[model samples]
Structures are given as C-alpha cells and as structure tokens.
Target: MSKRYTPREMLEKLISFNTVSDRSNLDLITFVETYLAEYGVTSIRVPDETGTKAALHAHIGPSEDGGVVLSAHTDVVPVKGQAWSQDPFASWVSNGKLYGRGSADMKGFAATVLAKVPDFIAADLQRPIHIALSYDEEVGCFGAPPLVRDMLAKGPRPSFAIVGEPTNMKVVTAHKGIAVYKTTITGHPAHSSQLHRGVSAISAAAKLISWLDAQTADNKAKADPDNAFEPPYTTLHSGVIKGGEAHNITAQHCEFITDFRLLPGDSKEAWLEAYRTFIDSQVLPDMQAISGDCGIEVEELAYVPGLSEEADGLAETEARGLTGDNARHVVVYATEGGIFQEHGVSTVVCGPGSIDQAHQADEFIELVELDRCAAFLDRLIGRLS
Candidate 1:
C-alpha cells in the first residue's frame, strides 16, 4: 500500500494552516518540517534576515549535480473582505473541486509535493529530488530571496526547477517580472482659495500618474516581446491612491503603489528611470518650490522578476517527456523560477490547476487535476530512473 497522502487530504491539511503573506508562515513551515522529518529527511531553513519568515529546502534522493527541484510558496494572500461559502482556513471539497484560500494559488501543489515524499524516498534514485517551499511569495515575492541566497551561498546548484504554480500541468517557460513600488507625495495643506500657497498632492499624484501613462504608452520599444502575454509587453500601473480629507482644503499627503511586470531581458533600472526622471524633472520641483519641506519620492516595496521562456533544450526536453507534453507555454503569473534561473538553474512552470480560479473568492482545484499531477510526478520519477 502507498503511504502517499491523498490529494483531498493534502488540500485540507494545507488550508488548515493560515499562512497569510503578511503574517508569519512559521506554523505552515513547522507542519511541513514535521511532515518531512517523519520520512527521515533533513532540510535547511533559510530565514529572511529580519528573522520573521523562512523558506525550506529538503533533498530526498541521492546528492548529485543536475538534480530537479519541486518548488512552491507556503504563503497565501489575505482573506479580508472576501465572501466565501466555506471558511478560508478550512478546505471544502464540493462538486468535484477543493475550495480554500490557498487551494488554487496553490497549497494544492505544496500538498502534492509533500504527499509524494514516500514515492520519492522509495525510488532507487540517482539524483536529488528537492522540495523548495518558500514564504511571502504573494507579497511581491519577498520570501524567496533568502532561500535563493542560501542556494547561491551554498555550492552545487540544481539542474531545473518546477515551480508548481497551477498551470494545469502545462509547461511554462516565460513570464513578465513585476517590481512594485510605493510613492509618497507630501505637500502643505492650505485654504482651497489659496491654490498657489500650498501644492496639491493630488496634482503631484497626477504628475506621477502621467509619467506612468507615458511609460505604458512607450513600452513598445523593449528588447524582446512575446505576444503570448495578454498585452504582449511589459506593463506599469498604479494600484492604490489616497490624499485629502475633504474637497475644501489642499491635500496634505498622497501615496500610491506601482506595479511593473517587465518583459524578458528588459532592464529593471531602465523601467524605473523613466518614472524617476518624471519625479526629478516635474513633480518635485513644483512641490519643493511651494514649501522647503514639500517633496515627492518613490521606494520599492516588493519585486518579482519575470521568467523568460528561452530555455528549450535537453533539460526542457526531459521535463516535457516527464509530463507527456511535446509543447511548452508562458505563464502570465510570476514565480521564483526566474530567480532560480538567474542562479544557473533551468526552470519550467508546470502544476495542477488553472490560475483563473486562483486568488479569488471560493478558490478551487479539480480533484482530477491533482490526480493528473500525481501521475505526472510518477512519470517524472520513471523518466529520471
């Protein structure tokens, strides 16, 4: 009899852990660590320098060069203000789908990976089967850097990474990287009649937004572009904006967030420079001129780099064969694969559910998909052998 945990059972267990992105994922990490220990596996916890969160790396097979890594994030986005038929922390399987907060954006993948440990341990493996469970991936991919740094500082890199981010098990090779930023526009509040006496933070916000408009309009000139992405290009957008208390007075402060998902080979500095130039050339001068203390500034809150789909060689061929797909794809969502690729590990994103159902109310994954993924893993094991 197989010791592997069933897909539904894995989904339930994963949902039971509230690994929200902002909160510590230590509970989830502890659960996985305990689970892995049961199989007699030793792992490393690469904690973020702040010591608040950590990512895990465990190898269950032979220690050798060019092995494979199955990776996923342990954190899920918050469930605040979302309506659900079932509890976000407790999973429900109904109408043939498992529903939970991380059910699709993918605790499902993590569960599957953990369940298959017995399979991996039982095999006569010649190479390592590494489990890379990361933290804080939803908050601009912050938790993955420490683990990536750990891999970098440690010798012996893996050959490929399978970022299990719910592509319905299709192979994805490229995606746009998203670097998020928050800008602060500080201005003096004065009587509405005295417009010139106090600079309008909203107006300053407009200046910054105009630059973003120009950047979006001018993204046509990137190094390489893939039409497969919805926009067929990198994109920059302002997410949140806040300023005045009432319409009567000049707004004292304004703040907003920006998201930049860059195309492959597109330099991050170049994208950021466009907005910096706008702030320097336009917004700051007027604000500073109004009052010596007035100013506008930007800071990166989070960054997740896009993965280019240029890797289509022997290793990719091996992944393709394992999953029984002769073709490859590009995922619109972001993952740690780009970071892994940056560190000399080839990566392909293939997993068990559709991203369409992820990160929303009543998030779910079809049980059939999980079963298919388990079969896919079995195929991978056979091919590796």
Candidate 2:
C-alpha cells in the first residue's frame, strides 16, 4: 500500500519541481492533475498561447451553486544569485522550519490544500470547493487572467476566491495594483569628440529617469491622507537600465524598465497617459531635433489591478471565522486576489508564512505556520460540509 503523505511531505514533493517562472510548469501541473485524479476529481487545463504552461481549475462537491475557490501559483522565483545552504529545489527541515525555494511563498499552501483532498472527498459538502493553480506569477502575474477568464466562461462561477499569498494567516482585503513598462530611446551615434553630431541616447535616457524620479517624489507628496496603504501613496521606480558599450562612443540605443504600484481607486491610465505624453512631447521632440530618426518608444509590459475594499464581506467574513482574526490588512505587494476581484469574484488573501521570507536567500516557512494553515483549512472544510 502507498504511504499517505502529510502536508509537509506533499510540500517536499512540490519543492522538487523547480518551477521557476522562466521554466515550463507542465511537470508540476501534471503531478497535480494526476494526484487529483486518484481522488476522482477532474481538473480543467487552460494553456497559455505557447502550450508550454497551463493553469489548472478543479471543483469538488456539488457544483450547482456558487462556492469558494482556493487560489495559488505554481511558479517559484529563480534562486540564481541567492546564497542558499542547501539545494533550493530539495526541501529540508531543521529547527522547526521547512526550507526551500517555494516553501514559504507558497507551495506550502498548495500542499495543505492537497493534503486535505482526502477529507474533502469524504465530506458531505453542500457547496463545492475550487482549486485554482496558475503559472508564471512570480514574473508579473501573467498566468492568472487566462485561468480566471476560463473560470468565468464556464458554469458554476465561484462567488468567492481566497488567494493564498502568504499573509501569515491574516486576512488581507486590499493590495496595490502593479503596472510595468519598458521605455527605449534611439539616437544617432557619433564619436565622443563630435558630440554635437550625435544625439546621446544615454543622455536622453538619463533625463527621462531623472524626470521619473521627480514625478515619483511628486507622487509621494500628493499621497491621500485617507489612503490606508503604507506611505498612503502610489509608488514608482525603475529597476533595470541598459545602454552604451564604451566611453568613447555615444550610445545609439538605451532602454530602461520601470513599474508603479497604484492604490485602489487611483487611475492607472491617467498616470500612464501623463508619462506617455511627456515622452512624446518633450523627449521625442528634443531627440528629433538632433536626428529625425531619433525617437522614444514606451511599451506596457504587464498590469495587475489592485483589490479594492469595496468587495462584499462574504469572503472576508468566512476567512475571519476560519482564522479567528478580526482585522484586515492592506498589503504593499500584489497578488492574484486583484485579478479575481476585477473579474467579479469577492476575494480575500490569507495564507501561512510571511512575505518577509519570500524571494530571499535560504527561504523557509515555519512548521507552526503550516500547522495553523492546516487547522484553518480544517475549519473551512467543516463549514463547507
């Protein structure tokens, strides 16, 4: 007979996949589908355009009425530069902590859900339970929209979705939206001595970056006093910039990637439009004056909208009842909770572990946190049954 595995054992198996955002999550998806199949639950796969990655959606119990969904992402961030004491893909336990890449951020939640599959199967539930697993979330939440769209199109749409995004079992009702963009500047190249003959792309990029800094500061100054988010304002910054080969030559091309986090009810389009206008009217015109071919291109890379507090209290109430927490938090990070909310699902974020441990070297989740999550799920199962 096959040995029955606990949540920790299942998490050990999940950690072995190495489902980094850049790599395909097909192997992990297959493992989950096969595991669910053994318990007589069939999952629906929504594949990305390339067919290399997919999101899995499955429902257990009566599907006639709207039910609750447990949401999680399958991908883990890369550990390329992070220093780890052991293999990041192979989990280990020491001093009451489970250490691995996705151990805390959050294969732990997925494992807890899977570990309770037997209980879910045996329970006589009046309402269904949903399991939503997606790919490539660490990159930019790229995998959630398609999966959510598929869920909406199909019948028995979930009324509430609980995104397990490692809130240390606290219920989080709101989080900031994220918008990412890449801006490229092209210019005429000329030798350093003939600087006037060339439009320096790097110089133009520098000015734009400086302008972004000023704009960010202005944003900080204009924060709404009533906003609940930290700093009570939308924030922006550029993370990557690239240009130029040597000091002797003017760079012909320069590029930088920037992103902003928006408070709920803030207008993302308004901010993006203002930046685009500045690029077109100020940056491009100056470049064009030096060289007609010189130009600037701004492209939107990814967007994940914020989860608003406007959601009806159904999910929040359920989560609070399960965890016995009366307070709700507004987080600084983004999650699939936003996407679910935007698509008309009342969503709340609650899970084990801490965001502080996420994407860090030697990332680990406390065994106590896992136990808490298991108990929370047990309460959820009891309520559903």
Candidate 3:
C-alpha cells in the first residue's frame, strides 16, 4: 500500500530539505518524483543547462485538453543572515503556526498539494490536474518559462493555471512585471586629486542610481489613485552595489544591480530603451570623453511579464468560485502566473499565508491558512470531478 501523509506531515518532510535558491533542489525534486511514483503517476523533469536544478510537472486524470494546473516554485531565499528562533530547514509547529524558511513564501502550498495527491488521483477527475514545480523563483522567476514550455509540449493542454504564491488565499487577477538588470561602469583610475584625468566609475554609478530614484519618484507622483496595486505605480529599485578601490583613488570599475516592477500595461522595452538612451547619450559619452577606454554596459539579468486581468478568465473564475472571493485583488510581486499567462493559459495567483510573513526571520504560516488552502484544494478537486 502507498504511504499517505497528512498535510502537516508532508510539510515537515518538505521543510527538511534545504532548497535555497543557491543550492540544488534535486533532492526535493527526487523526493516528489518518488512519492508520485508510489501512486502510479509519472512526472517529467525539465533540467536547467547545468543539470544542478530542474522543474517537475505531472498530470493526473484522463489525457486530454482543458485541464487545470497547480503551479508553485520549489526554491526558497537564503536564510544565512536571518536570525531564526530555530533551524530554518527544520519544521516546527508552535502557537498554531508552522515555522520554516519556505513555509509562507511557499512550501505551504506545495505541501498541501502533495498531501492531497492521493485524493486527486481517486477523485475520478474528468479534467486533468497538472502539478508544476519550478526552481529559482526567489532570484527571479527564471525557472518558470522553461518549465511552462515543457509542460505545454508534453502534457494535456491546461485551460487554467493557479500559481500558488502567498496571497492569503485571495484570488489575484493581475500583478506587476519584473525586469532585473546589472550595470557595469568601467573608468580610468587616477589619484582623487586628479579628478579631470580619470573617470570615476563610482561617481557614474551614483548618478545612474539617482536617475532611477528620480524615475521612481516621478512614477509615484503620477500614480493612479484607483489602481489596485499597493503603490499603484511602477517602481524602480537598486538593490546591490559595489566598487571603488580606495577613497584616495578614482574607482576603475563599479557595478550595481537594479530591478523595475512595471504595472501590467506598461512596456518593459520602452523603459529599457529610455534607460539605455540616457546612459549612451549622456553618461557613457561623458566618461569616454575623459578616458577613451571608459564605457558602460547594461545586462538584463531576468525579465518576468506582468499578469493582466483577463475578461472572464477561467482560472480567475474557478479560483473565485472555490474561495468565494469576488473582491478585486492585485499584487505587486511577480509570480509564475505571468509566465503561464504569457503562454496563453489563463492564470491567477491564489494561495495561503500573507506575503508579509515570507522571507523573514522565523517565517511562519498560520495553521489555519494551511487548513484553508486544503479546503480550497478539496473544492477544486470536486470541480474537476
């Protein structure tokens, strides 16, 4: 007989594995594959080029089109700098909450889905239920596109996809898109006293960062008050920066990472073009004038399209039906739903826990949240049946 685990038990098992974005999630993937195999379900692995990471997908029920997909990422952010009350990889229940690194950010949703696999299998589903687990969602939604591509090619075409991101189980019809970029500034080195002889990469980077800040402020000022997003506008943020050899010398090299979270209807290309124009026409020319070798390079690290609200979308309709949540909701965070939506699948973001609890020290999800999620899945099973 196949062993069955409760949602809590499965959550404990999942939390035991450290699937931090920097580490390989193969152990967790293998465990999921093995567990599904126990129930006679076969899943496909979509491995990255390095084979150190993979995305997994499985289909249950009749092999046919117009199915539903349950999507969630398997990776969690690093807990290195966090001060946790207990081991981040070890699951513990206290005060009606389950605590762990990925509990809220989203292993909670995955655990609930896995625990109910047996139920899904036995539900005599008329339409298939696809399970999609991807990697590296924390760094950026990098792993989802390939995973979605493989799923579309290999399995029954899914009509709807529900991304299990932490949204307090609210049905989210739209979300902001994310574009990550790294800018490297190259300049000539010279003594600080000889400012005119050398281009200071650090100073150039500061100016660029200031430009991004100005854009952010401009967007905020013109934001729509009626928009559902938290800030109701696109946002620009520079997260990491490094460079400079010494205070006495002009820096030869400097680099910084920045990201833009654009509203659903905004054009990422337009923003990129404007930014590049500023660098090429203004910043780069000034640097090169002082030192011929000085230059600026901008590289796109990742890009995730935003989820746009669809007219009577099947995923949103179904999710709203299951949760009885008719309230309009939109998220500022990016999720795999955008990737799925871009591929022509109607997608929505709905899952347990609050985003506030995610990626925090002693991260936890309310036990009641998991219960609510399980109930939602049960309703979903019934709908498919």
lDDT of 1 by residue, 125-211 (tens): 777777898988887777777787776566346778888999988888788788888999888898999988987888889878877
The CA lDDT at 102 in model 1 is 88
Error of 3 at 59 (Å): 0.7
The C-alpha TM-scores of every prediction are: 0.93, 0.96, 0.97
What's the lDDT for all of these models?
A: 0.81, 0.89, 0.93
User: Largest lDDT belongs to which candidate?
Assistant: 3
**C-alpha lDDT of candidate 2 relative to the true structure:** 0.89
Candidate 1: where are CA atoms >4 Å away? 1-4, 49-52, 220-226
Please write out the lDDT profile of model 2 over residues 278-348, one tens digit for every residue.
Answer: 88888888778888999888899999999898645788988988988887588989999999988889999
- What is candidate 3's TM-score against the reference? 0.97
Model 1 CA lDDT for position 298: 86
Off by over 4 Å in 2: 1-3
Top candidate (TM-score): 3
| Winner of 1 and 2 under lDDT | 2
